[model samples]
Target: MHRFANPTRFLRLAAAVLPFSAAVAALCLGAGLVWGLFFAPPDYQQGDTVRIMFIHVPSAMMAMGVYAGMAISSAIALIWRHAIADLIAKASAPIGATFTFICLLTGSLWGKPMWGTWWVWDARLTSMLIMLFIYLGYMALWQAFDDQTKAARAAAILALVGAINLPVIKFSVEWWNTLHQPASLITMEGPKIHESLLWPLLLMIVGFGAYYLTVLIFRVRAEIHQRRTRMLRMAQADRHNAMQAAD
Candidate 1:
């Protein structure tokens, strides 16, 4: 991990991995969407509406997954003062937030037909909403200061603090009398879903993960270049001012 602290080395690594991640993302998402939507049999109960799970479930999982990643990166940044880790956490904020929003949106859409309402204050839904707020707050903290060092530190702390919500979000349905269903894909007994439904869902989840990786690499690389440009400009300004003073 420390070896990747060097931006150039990390960028080279990212360049090599980018193509593979992008390809996986495109292929899996294409295959998964088509298979789940057009080919998979409808649920005995929900009928056509079950198709939404392909989009909703994966987005929901990625929303939490991305936050988990941010929390880990934030911990690394705080503990080791890893610059690349900080940039990674920073780059991930918007993407995580986007995923959270999609989860909420799709959940609502799915809920309307199944639950007979477009929204609910159930434990899972409420906690997921809180997750979205936490994501937004995390992003806002990064922009709250001019000194990026302070901003990074502040944001890292918030990220670490907000991580407590993750478990609550995950267990909310089990802990409370919620409208949400219990775990089907991941449980002590393994997936309860049928193979036909499960396979495409798994593919979608993989695609989403790959998509996140592909985007994170691009964002982190852009951040590295931008930071380097800023440093070069500041150095030039400092040298010019020193020369003028000497004159």
Candidate 2:
């Protein structure tokens, strides 16, 4: 991990991996959507409404998974002062937030038909909503500070604290009565769903993972360049100040 601390090395690695990740993401996501929507057998009860699960489930998984990544990165940055780790946490926040939003939106769309309402304060739903707010708060903290170091520290602390919510979101269905169903695919007994529907859902999840990695690499590279440009400007300013003082 420390080997990746060098921006140049990390950028080279990212460049090598980006094209493959982008291609796999596009192919898998397109194929998964097509398979799930048109070919997969629909739920006997929910019928076509079940098609929404392909998008909703993948987004929901990525939403929590990305936050978990941020929390781990935050821990690395705080403990080891890994520069790339801090940037990763920063880069992941907005993407995680986007997936969280998508999860909420699609969940609501799915709920209207099954639950007879577009919204509910069920434990699972409410906990997921809180997770979304936590992502927003983490991003907002970065913008609130002028000092990058201070901001990163503050954001890291918040991320570590916010990680407590992940488990709450995960187990909310079990801890309390909720309209949301319990885990079907990831149970101790293995997936309860039939193989026909499961394969496409798995493909969508994989595609989303690839998509996140591709975006993260691009964002981190951009952030490194931005930091370098800022440092260069600051160096020029210091040189001008020294010259004026000598004069």
Candidate 3:
């Protein structure tokens, strides 16, 4: 694991995985949306409003899931000083943040019909909102310092601290009588969602996840290349100065 921590080596590995990931994400997403939107039956209660579930639920799941991933990466980076982990955490931030935002937006849209309001002060909703802020904070910390090691350590600790929010978001329903619904997919007796809506919803969730992974690899690779380029330029400048001094 440490051996692959070298950015150059990570770049090579990422390059190899990129094509396969891209293909899988694209295929899964395509099929998932088609099945979710078209083939699936509308909810008896929510009707076409249920259509939002295809996009909303998956994005919400990914939002939390991605943050968890970021937290784990942050831990690895802080403990092992794994270079690639920082790259991954940095790359995952915007994607996860976007998903969280999407979850909130779509939920509002879904709520306007069902809950009769665009927003709620429920625990789940609030915690998720906080999670979004945490994402922004993590990104800010990474860029706040001029020193790389200091920045990474600071951001990693912040991420770890924020991890408490993950479980809060997960069990918010059971912990309190919030407006948010309970778990539909990963439940005590399996999914409570009907088969018609269930499969498509799952597909979309998976597709969204794959999409995040596809972009994460590309972004991290670019970051590695950019750092390498910066190093090369600095080295070139130093060598040029040394040669001039010799002359």
Candidate 4:
């Protein structure tokens, strides 16, 4: 934690990990999509329409996972003042939001075929929508402040507060009757999905996680460089002002 706080050390670690993450993401996504789309058996009831689950399920899972990660990073930044943690949280928001958007879009697409409607106010669907709003709000909060430090603090608090929605999203199906299906992959008894479908879904989930890591490294690295550039310009301005005062 503290050891990796330094930008240089973090950058070195990211460089080492980036190639592996990228490779795994590419391999898993390619294999999973091919297996899920072409090889796996379709749902007996839904037929080809079931194929959308490969993308929708993984993106939905990743949306929550990424937000959980952001909240954890925000907590670290607030508690330990880990310099890299705030940047990680900032970098994760857009990616999480994109995943959330994909989940909602695909869910709507899948729903129209299965449920005879493109939209619903079901517990799971509504909570997932709220999660998307929270992600957007978190990103907006960061931009609300001119001072990065203040922005980070405000965003961190919002992230921590927004975390309450996560459980709601997760358990919404159980808490109420909903058109959405209950948990299949993570049931207490075990995954209810058959092996052929399950394997490809698992692969997609892993790929999504790896992809998030790959992109996070790039975004965080860019953020570090941008912050450094901003600091340098500010210092130069201060020095010029000092020189003027001396003259």
Q: What TM-score, over all chains together, does every model reach?
A: 0.89, 0.89, 0.86, 0.89
Q: lDDT winner between 1 and 4, please give it.
A: 4
Instruction: Put the candidates in lDDT order, highest first.
Output: 4, 2, 1, 3
Query: How many pairs collide in each candidate, listed in order?
Result: 0, 0, 0, 0
Off by over 4 Å in 4: 1-5, 168-191
* Candidate 2, superposed: residue stretches over 4 Å from native: 1-5, 168-192
**Alpha-carbon deviation at 63 in model 1, angstroms:** 0.9
Give the worst 10-residue stretch by lDDT in candidate 1.
182-191
lDDT of each prediction vs. the true structure?
0.84, 0.85, 0.78, 0.85
Give per-residue CA lDDT, model 3, range 78-180, as digits (tens).
8898888988888899999999999878877876877678885545566667778888988989899987668878888888888965576557644664344
lDDT per residue for candidate 2 within 17-98, as digits (tens), equals 9999999999999999999999999877677888888988889889989999999999999999988899999999999999
Candidate with the larger lDDT of 1 and 2: 2
Superposed on all Cα atoms, model 1 deviates from the true structure by an RMSD in Å of 4.2
Q: For model 4, how does the per-residue alpha-carbon lDDT over 1-247 read when each residue is reduced to its tens digit?
A: 3123469989999999999999999999999999999999987767787788899888988998999999999999999988799999999999999999998898788778766788855555666788898999999999999999899989999999889766765586446643455433221113256678989999999999999999999999999998888887988999999999999
